[model samples]
Target: MRSKVLITGSSGKLGKRVLEFNEGLSFLSPSSKDLDITSETSVNKFLNQNSFNTIIHCAALARMMECEENPNKAFLINTQGTLNLVNKVRDIEKSCKTNIRFIYISTDGVYPCINGNYDEDSPTIPYNIYGWSKLGGETTVRSLENFCIIRTRFFDPLNIPFSESADDIITSSIEIDRLAKIINFLVKDEFNGVLNVGNEATTEFLRYISHKPNLKKCKRSDITKNLNFEIAKNASMNISLMKKILSS
Candidate 1:
């Protein structure tokens, strides 16, 4: 029998893409209203009614500025909300005597972006509230026997959003469609622990400006001067492990 999968945050871009690339797996995709992860009672009520062998948790307070402005709300949803799901999953798995795999969507922000080339064993000192909140969620997911924490950044290539691209700023941000494909493959792998996925170290302008011809090339200052929070500089992650897994 195919694994019964529960996909949270199906409304989000990543979640939606994952659903699109189902890869012949059985999926139970629910919107935020149907399964409010922030509410422990709501999570329990929903999961109790269904049985799942895998959970691809993509729900999160993902905005950087919003997380910084409202740290409490960020933690409530990203941290506490993840804990609620983890706890309940444990209960259900124990009762049913079946293994449940959890795939957590984490951010590359968990690493200090001071210098790039971060490996899986590198220090995890978050530079912002968004990273901290996701790290808290990671802590809970670690308690599970089978879990994969994907730490990377992804952007919709079609929608660059910004008119200016910083040539100096670098990141491990991959195209949304590519990242979704990797996640679809990861769902079947039995790997436990964090897996860094994305392109090699490259400037933001070169990676992002290709899709937008009108986008002007600029220095990092031109972008950060207007923003309140600091955009991660050189947030590149080493994806050697990810490639190995995909190849295997």
Candidate 2:
């Protein structure tokens, strides 16, 4: 039997790409109105009406400055919302006698960013509120028996949103379409635990130069001065595990 998949935050950028790449699968892409992860009642109601063997949770309050401005909202949506989903999923799994595979779309921001090439075993000390909230969600996801936490950095290749790129700050960022394809492959395999998914480490400026030639080069300090929250200087991840899994 084909696995029934439920994808939250289907309207977002990454979610939309995941949907596009995961074609021909039995997917339920519910809008926020149809299923709100923040509300336990909403999650329960949706789960009761629909049965899915897999869930790809993509909903999160991701902006660093916004999270700093309203920590309460960030916690409510990213942390509490994740808890509600996990709790309800656990209940549904128990009652239905089925194992639900949870795929959590986490971030590389969980690390302190003091150094790059962070692996799955790296120490998690978030530099900002956004990272803290995501780390909180990671905690809940870790408690689950059958779950995969993917910590990745991805951006749209066609749409480079920024006019300037930081030359000093580096990341192991992959194009969103490529990342989505990898995610589709992983979700079907018998892989459970945290996986770091991205490309070779590169500076923000070099990464965007090809796509946006007119983009101005700037240092981390230039960008950080305008923002109230702290940002990672080097958020690159070690993708050896991801490569090994994909190869096997």
Candidate 3:
């Protein structure tokens, strides 16, 4: 039987793109309707039924506006939901003696550095509820010994139009295909820890949106002389760790 790699939040934009990477692998993607990750019973029951060697946690409450508007809902899905999955994985790994690689997709939003690049060692001081919830999920993933958490920034998804933002934040942005390729590589490698994954170079949010050459770009500084968002000015990760894996 082919080893199964299960992806949560398969209905989301990034998860859908990951399915199309065609990297000679088998993946099981469960839509939110099929898998209610927020429910502990649902998650545990599903994992029990399916045998998987890897779990890619892509499910998250991603809307910044919604998080700000209804923080309770965000906490339910982003924090507690993640805990449900992580705890289940830990129990299975302990009992079965099978190495299960758990990869949590994190965001650079957790870093509060307003004007500098952040690495794996950077202090995380999430400035908003959304970032805090994601960090909370990260803590759950970190507690597992056989897991790898990836702190990823904005990467343009395939076939989706990029949204424009004027913040001078620098992050390693890659195509969705590139990210999927890296994920495939991770499954075969012996890496078992936290790592940062992204493109070879750091790019600004404005440049990422403008890459298509058709979308209108707005300067964030012009609209909000005092920026309203609590995003880091430049919390890009150095993709050296990812590069080493890709080169090998």
Question: Which candidate leads the pack in lDDT?
Answer: 2
Cα error, residue 63 of model 3, in Å, equals 1.2
Error of 2 at 28 (Å): 0.7
| Top-down lDDT ranking | 2, 1, 3
- The models' CA-based lDDT, in order, is 0.90, 0.91, 0.75
Can you list the residue pairs that collide in candidate 2? none
Return whichever of 2 and 3 wins on lDDT: 2
TM-score per candidate: 0.97, 0.98, 0.88
RMSD of 2: 0.9
Question: Can you write out model 2's per-residue Cα lDDT over 1-248, one digit (the tens) per residue?
Answer: 57678999999999999999875567999999999989999999998999889999999998778899999999999999999999988998888888999999999999888799999999999998888999999999888889999999898878999899999999999999998998788778899999999999999999989998899999999998998888889999999999999999
lDDT of 3 by residue, 115-155 (tens): 55567778889888889999999999889877777777655
lDDT, candidate 3, equals: 0.75
Which number leads on TM-score?
2
Give candidate 1's error at residue 239 in angstroms. Answer: 0.7
Comparison by lDDT, 1 against 3, better one = 1
